[model samples]
Target: MIASRKQWRCKVNSCRHTFSVTSGTIFANHKLPIQTYLYAIALFVNAVKGISALQMARDLNIEYKSAYVLLHKIRKALLEQREFTTFSGEVDIDGTYIHPAPRKANKKIDRIDYRLKENQNPEKRCILVAREHYTAEEKAKNPLYRGAKSTQVVTFGETQSTVKHFADKFVERGTRINTDESHAYDVLYAILRFMHGKSQGRIP
Candidate 1:
């Protein structure tokens, strides 16, 4: 069979790395030809009952272990493909806590425990998420940001600089940003307004 291998190149200007289809993948060490591996994975994903390595091996006439490994590899790629990038338009910013249980060891009898137990709580990092439809003007002005747009992840912290960085990266300068009256965002509106001044856009 004619093996057709996909190739990928690093886009970073500082680094140049050319790799085959199996690069940075679970299949990198497999001895099977690239074409066969791709076909097996496609069939496995399409299987109605959810294909197992043993089933794939029986169907594709390959080793059971190889089929299992390939399935896991595809699963990783599926996850990485679903990562969130940015947001636009009337965006909503909010934070939710994901508290991890506090850990404590056995205390010695009558020993003075002087550790900051409250500070040791694994504070869940903040999350910012938003989504909006793509407009004609936005697509024209920022072509790179245009697409069948979906959700976005926002930044954290109570500093203007942090908010400014998030605004620059996700929110276009002139778009209306809908957020609560958290003191952290007091200057966010003004900073975004300043950035919009340079572009003639208004905070909606």
Candidate 2:
């Protein structure tokens, strides 16, 4: 530890790496004082309707551009570090293709069946969306959580692997997942079951 700079240095003879407590944190390479970041956080949290860059600039006495950039950085850090709470209650899942539609050939003889697996585009992808609804009873208990409690977006299509991964990561045991009769959802039933055997109505 370098007491003068309050930084740590690694020494391996051939390799030397220097870092500080905030080296990889949001405060990394920060020009403003550490207390300023805490004060900014306080302002951000207390803003009921949400604070604007101009407002933040006036409150923090920083440039509008600086406040804007800082606000976005804080938002990005929150998204990256936020702990995801799995959905509960009635859940609806659906997916749609996100790639270019198949194009027909110019000539009749040149035409090919694009519906075939071999003719499908390799760049094709699917965007999946899932939402968990809040019951009226639950909403009455807490009006703040009305409508959909949680929404999850899947970058890939509905498949065995994707279904299993989604269930294991973003869903709790015994939560009814409403999905179409796609073969992909078949795996979800097995995911929440005990080691001995599969449970009935695990996901319907």
Candidate 3:
């Protein structure tokens, strides 16, 4: 579904409250086309290396902070997408530590050794993306990444909220979910059961 059609809905089931995706987002009141935001995501994914928000805004024909908000939203959507898609069947997970790019020096200075120790890595991130050999093509159509299954983006946090949300929207209840030995999934039982209730009216 397109983001333009996003409806305000509460994250909690017990509440009948409704809210927009922007409710808790940085782009809440911004006046811009949802497509522009989508484009920002495309740029982030397609960028060979990191690109500044200013460059993104220039390329997308939008404001600099608009670009920043767009990037923020893209990351937000990525998190949601990753949360929804549970890794099942021969899942592969990994982590990476990215080093900060060297700042441009005002003037040439003597070279100084400033490297991290052997075990002390730079800023690290945990990625949680999944794959299913049978559902690869079908899942690729998901709006989040819209890329090939081999490169489906991963996410942070192990809460079942996202997995359950995905199941409620796509996967059928009782449809077994698979994952690595990450104990994070231990919380899925209740989430899965809760989602099953939400899926009843939608799934045939």
After superposing candidate 2, which stretches have Cα over 4 Å from the reference?
Answer: 1-83, 105-108, 139-147, 190-204
Best by lDDT: 2
Local distance difference test, per candidate? 0.60, 0.73, 0.53
Candidate 3 residue lDDT tens string, 1-204: 235656655567798576666666655665887677667667798888867899998998987987886777676766566534443443322222244334546665843334545433345333444443446556666646444343233334345664444434544444444443444555444222122234343211
TM-score to true structure, per model: 0.39, 0.46, 0.40
lDDT of 1 by residue, 33-108 (tens): 8788778877966787777778888877888887787788787776568645565565654444344444445676
Across 1-204, the per-residue lDDT of candidate 2 in tens digits comes to: 999988888887676788887899887888777887888889998888789989999999989998898888787787687457787666666666767456788899989887887887877777666677778877788788744644445355678788777777877887777766577777765222222243443432
Worst 10 residues of 2 by lDDT: 190-199
Top candidate by TM-score? 2
Model 3 ranges with Cα > 4 A deviation: 1-27, 33-35, 38-51, 84-88, 100-204
Candidate 3 has what TM-score?
0.40
- Candidate structures ordered by lDDT, highest first: 2, 1, 3
RMSD of each: 12.0, 10.6, 14.7
Q: Where does candidate 1 clash, by residue pair?
A: 128-154
lDDT of 1 at 171: 65
